[model samples]
Target: MNDTLHVVEKLTEWRARALEFEREIQKAVLGQARVIRLVTICIFARGHVLIEGDVGVGKTTLLRSASRALGGDFARVEGTVDM
Candidate 1:
């Protein structure tokens, strides 16, 4: 059916895009390959992730780097005691 063909085409395009993104991330992140790969797998597997660590441990760096690699939008939120 035409609808099926359209769906297939869209999926193919999306997969290709995700692959390209993975390559870009690999290039940007020189070290920390394991962490990066884990994050990537989590994303693809549709699993939720919680990264907790002391400050200045590259948490934001990892997210920003991944965002750039994925060619996608990135948003950062800070936790507050009141909220």
Candidate 2:
């Protein structure tokens, strides 16, 4: 019983932190609520995310903003294939 209570408490705390993180990211990346929400979900789930979009679609901006908000490291790589 005690262990279950502890787990529940930790989950609640983690949820609060995730919400706070979403708000922080929203400040920088406007007009992308869905993207922000998805990123936040990924953070809480401890999952990786792959963002693909055309150039100038705020992809890098979104990732960078999320990293800053979550206080985590951000690394990006750009690649192109030649025919």
Quote the lDDT for 13 in model 2.
98
lDDT to native, each model: 0.77, 0.88
Best by TM-score: 2
The worst-scoring run of ten residues by lDDT in candidate 2 lies at 74-83
Best by lDDT: 2
- TM for every model, in the order presented, reads 0.60, 0.80
Clashes of each: 0, 0
Which digits, one per residue and each the tens of the lDDT, describe model 1 over residues 35-69?
77678778877887777878876778788878777
Query: For residues 22-51, could you state the per-residue lDDT of candidate 2 as single tens digits?
Result: 889888888998988898898779899988
